[model samples]
Target: MRRESETCTYWSELIAYLYGELSADERSEFERHLLACAICREELSGFERTRAFVRTWKARAEEAAVGLPAISLGSAPNQPQWRQALAALREFFALSPAWLRVTSAVATLVVCALAALAVAHAELRVSSEGVAFRTGIFKRPPAQTKAASSEPLYTQEEMERIVAERIAAARAQMLDRIQSEQLATREQAQSMPHPSPAQASAQQPDFEHRVRRSEQAAVALARDDDAPRLSDLLSEISD
Candidate 1:
């Protein structure tokens, strides 16, 4: 039992010894100990058996690995080569400098924006008036400056008829404007407070009497002026 306990205590050393990983002196000492102890001898034999089993397992695993092709976890077997290339490119870019990546992204965005603007700026319009250009970057085209022809497109009689029609339309518009103004004036007058009938009558009489008094005064002043009268002429002729 004591020998058994001692052998158990050297369990880690026994594993190292089975792998031949110990120093020469330590291996020799352990071998001498094994010779003197039956329990140690049995334990070393068990370790040797376990090492043989592990070697057999490792050999079998290597053979199996050799028979099968290597499969990468990063890429699928059936995926296209372009996808793999793109993935490699992405990885390269990811490993590139931060400034370079940012500059490329910004340059791409700016180019796209400028291209959109340019496309929008290339518009042209045609109409009966003339050709016109519409753009976001350039100024608007000037209005058509060509003067109308002096000669009328229509005959004289037709021109007169058109002129008459325009005059009639203008007259109608003027009449409509006058009527609207009169109606607005009438509405304003109706909105105002008016004097009572008796107050209006009283005011009229007073105003008429004042007018008559002013007329009589004007006649007296005219008679007193230095103009010859008909009675004076007759008296002068008799004298």
Candidate 2:
């Protein structure tokens, strides 16, 4: 009953049906259509024939009988306690330089990891007790700087300039939309050849409202237009 996108082709459904995994209702419907649809019927028949052929070959395959040999397990050579200790020492000295380096690196890494875990545990305890880790050996992130503060990434002025540009773009867009709406309202009023008494009275309020709105918008735009340029301010500060 799910509505599907027309753009999504039915290849996935066809694959499911080919695997004999379609729901009974869907399968029955598909089969009923297959009786009249030659292409689907032929494809289904071909798949069925391939499956039968594969099963036939499987049935004829002779399974190889495996015989495991009686494996004689070897025992370790018995050595005296002193000889065993000496052999161990010999083996340690026989290790290649590469293996020695690998062992040393692994040991160093494990020691470092354990030290980090211990330090982190102590730091977490301090944090849980409301004590800042930054006061001692650990350090916290730097405090937030002022918006007007200088940074290596960008001068305070540059960031301000970008923000100002964005704000100006948004204001311009909003102004355009308001103007277009006002123009549409004027067109609508002019299109009407005549107005009734009640309609004329209604028009008066709308006209007054529009005039007030226009004046407010004009004032807002004028102020925004004369606002200090962010880029210029930054340039002056940089100098």
Candidate No. with top TM-score:
2
Write down the TM-score for model 2: 0.32
* lDDT of each residue in 1-239, candidate 2, tens digit only: 01231223443455478798999998887777666766555545655544544433333332212344323223222444345445544443332234565787799999997787676654434555586532234657689976874537876756777878887898889888778877877888789868889889978897879867976886788788788876667777777
Q: What lDDT score is found at residue 9 in candidate 1?
A: 55
lDDT value for model 2: 0.61
Which regions of candidate 2 are displaced past 4 Å?
1-151, 227-239
> What's the lDDT for all of these models?
0.61, 0.61
lDDT digits (tens) for residues 39-155 of candidate 1: 667766655544444444444456667996434333133444445445545644543346668999999999997788687775768999999866766676789899989975776
